[model samples]
Target: MKKHCMGRVVAASAVLVSSGAIAFVPASAASATEADCDGIGVIGVFKAVESGASFNYNGRRVELQNESALDRYSRAEIKSGRKAGDRLWVDRSFHAFPDFKGIVSDQSAKSDGWKMCGPYTGSRTQSVFNANYAARACAEIDGTTLCGKWYVD
Candidate 1:
């Protein structure tokens, strides 16, 4: 009977967290200050590939550079893959990331012409300097748009 009671106590101790994670909170835990984190973070390295053109099949990355009050640049790097050669391309932006759902970065911010992804290179960059903006990376190929998550850079 004691063992069963202990098991029940232990089972009641844990809590579930968002992002499909499990956490254990002590029954004695006090209500502390509200958490400041919004739970958004780096989208990390990702891949964008299709039949006609495969760019960054191995890995692609979104980078935050020159962080400042007025000169930040969001870069997309096609780490490796078959050359995009104009058929495949990478795009990135600052301000809003893909996870925001209906919220998308300003269209004008995608200033780079489609030619941004050149046959000889695997990188392109765009700039939008803002204090509260985040980073988003995407690729266009074979009539499909693949986007990774976004994060506050």
Candidate 2:
């Protein structure tokens, strides 16, 4: 099953490569962030710490970039994968992420674009930023980062 799944990914990659949709790079090779976010590149998938939500930082760790850039890439990720159903859909259970902005380190200010629902006020449309780091009473007030608790299924 794993091999079959990987085969699909490889075939998809080949099609993308041939059509100039994305460049072809060996899995062992290093590519730029644009390539990674461009469908032709590999995205690093991360599971939500709490709800088992699955997401990708567009190949960069969420812990690394600024909010603006993160938003840009995340938007791309969401739009790029509709056919594959690779979106960060919030479950009806939790409903939404908390409002009221909190300050995040300037280091974490950028995001890969699509945060779960909570951090951006229940609108998956909002971008995640360092200013909205996990501390500010989002869901329960004084809780941990929303990303740590929310699922992206």
Candidate 3:
């Protein structure tokens, strides 16, 4: 459910930003959206951002400035091999997302989707799932970058 909320927020933000009606946003915000991100290495798994929007990557909690920022940080975290739940600071001031590369743990990768070792309680502790399922399923049951699923055993 959290992921869905964040996703909606990001989607809505994109609309607002494109419409040129979102106030208090930096002028460079337009550029950030057009960040030629293709071919750019993944920054890291997005944790929580200063504004409270967040997501799960490799079963870790990540926050971001918004959904777009979360997506950027999520990729970076995976590529950098940072541990689950690590934080990546998005520096919109510099148009960069920075990570602390040394904190990674070399753990074995797990299957895609939610891996619940126990019963589900519909809470943050139940199991990791695809961000899209939004808590409907005990686990999303697969992992993929496109859908923003990142669960490691």
Over 4 Å off in model 3, which ranges? 1-35, 38-48, 65-141, 144-153
Q: Give the least accurate 10-residue stretch of model 2, judged by summed lDDT.
A: 1-10
Error of 2 at 119 (Å): 12
Ranking by lDDT: 1, 2, 3
- Runs in model 1 deviating more than 4 A are 1-71, 85-122
Question: TM-score per candidate, in order?
Answer: 0.33, 0.18, 0.17
Model 3 / residue 106 / CA error / Å:
35
Model 3 over residues 102-130: C-alpha lDDT tens digits?
11111111111112122111222211222
TM-score of 3: 0.17
Cα RMSD, model 3: 18.1
Write down the lDDT of every candidate, Cα atoms only: 0.30, 0.22, 0.22
lDDT, residue 120, candidate 2:
22
Better of 1 and 2 by TM-score: 1
lDDT of 1 at 109: 30
